[model samples]
Target: MSRSTTATVARTQPKRAVLAAMLLLPALAFGLWNRPVDAQEAPVEIPAPATTLNETSASATAVFAGGCFWGVQGVFQHVAGVTKAVSGYAGGAADTATYDQSSNGSTGHAESIQVTYDPSVVSYGDLLQIYFSVAHNPTQLNYQGPDHGTQYRSTIFPLNDEQTGYAKAYIAQLDETGLFDGPIVTTVEPQKTFYAAEQYHQDFLTLNPTYPYIVVNDLPKVAALKQLFPDAYRDEPVLVGTL
Candidate 1:
């Protein structure tokens, strides 16, 4: 081939390579996006906690880490009695809580959400029921759907001894019934430091409903919450930063 033709071909090849990479940018941006074993994984309707704080009205906080906080936060936001749900990182140190750092899966931070609710209006037991049933898969060991890693593990970070007791009892209750085909692997972890994720991470599902990952993996979970617990599902989500 002529020298001029060789040079032209090299330049053309690089342009083609650039275009190819750009075409795959969407998938790259979201990271490993895995779908659950069953897209229609229905919520497990476990009995309400037999023991709960008798106080009919009071404010309380609960933190949950299951899969991606975007969907977990989204699910709780639509729950009737939850005042606010903020996506964040939990079970990790405060200094390593940034999203970019946590994404590496070595920061010991699991994507988590802080749910503030009026316990009087919605008991903590009710929240736990919804969490195990509708938020994400408890059988998933260290990941949820297309996402894999310890950062996506199913976990409950109870705030106190009472909350810890309730969580443990409920897991036992669900396990005995064989509610799940697989054993529930959710572990109760003591809260370390809950750090609110970046501004862009909060309220992501609500703002980006049509995004590919949300549509395929998360929207159905919300739909199940509405279908199974109509009384508890609210159409308008309670946003965190907004309140």
Candidate 2:
């Protein structure tokens, strides 16, 4: 080839390379940007298995903490699809935990519950709706009403990636829309060992209808839930007469 031709070809190579990169850049950016939201999107990480329950399986489990377990558990128990809502502790150390021990906050536990439900009847998202609007106040940073401590803090202990995704999305929606004046501080974390609250605490509302706290603070939530989601509420408790 002539020297002039060789020089022209060499100069053209740089422009060709730039053009190729430009062509590929959008495709690369598209993949990177739309990359499936990893499990949960934010600080919360949900394990993969929890959200995808086997279809052959009849039920799924969800854990949440909203102030005292009594109010949280009672609300879920009445929800039509929820087969069980056992108040307990989660997202803390794996030590053997109990109500008394967790109350101190040394155990790193929160008063929580393991809710077993038929996803066919209610969705994880629906359960969360009740959780946010009626289960407990997400705005309360570290306390719910009179209860004060990390134990009583609002939290979602997602069992799997889907739950994690849903939770983070919901919080993001609530935050973006300005649902709360302050930031939504509800913790979205992985599930941990769940220790059931003492039997007496299981159905505190039923067991102690006259308890001042139940009458004053907890019952209102139950009423609001029934009013809000009438179809989901069941008047009869699973434990029956005594909760």
lDDT of each candidate versus the true structure: 0.79, 0.67
Q: Residues 1-243, candidate 1: write the lDDT tens digits.
A: 542233223222333343334346757434423434353255666666667755454788999999888789999999998998998899889899986677768989999999999976788889998999999889889877667788889989988887888899889988888778688999999856788887777787888786555666688889888988899999999987642
Task: Please give, for residues 1-243, the per-residue lDDT of candidate 2 as tens digits.
Answer: 742233223222333343334446767534543444221111121122224323334798889998878778878877888888886778676564765466666667888978888888877777877887777878787687656777778889988886778788777777776545467789897756676765556666666654444554567677777777778788976552233
User: How good is model 2 by TM-score?
Assistant: 0.73
Q: Give me the candidate number with maximum TM-score.
A: 1
On the 0 to 100 scale, the lDDT of residue 150 in model 2 is 78
In candidate 1, list every pair of residues with a backbone clash: 33-146, 34-145, 34-146, 56-120
Relative to the true structure, candidate 2 has a C-alpha RMSD (angstroms) of 24.6
* True-structure Cα RMSD, model 1: 9.6
Question: TM-score of each candidate?
Answer: 0.82, 0.73
TM-score of candidate 1 versus the correct structure, residues matched by position: 0.82
The best candidate by lDDT is 1
10 residues in a row with least lDDT, candidate 2: 39-48
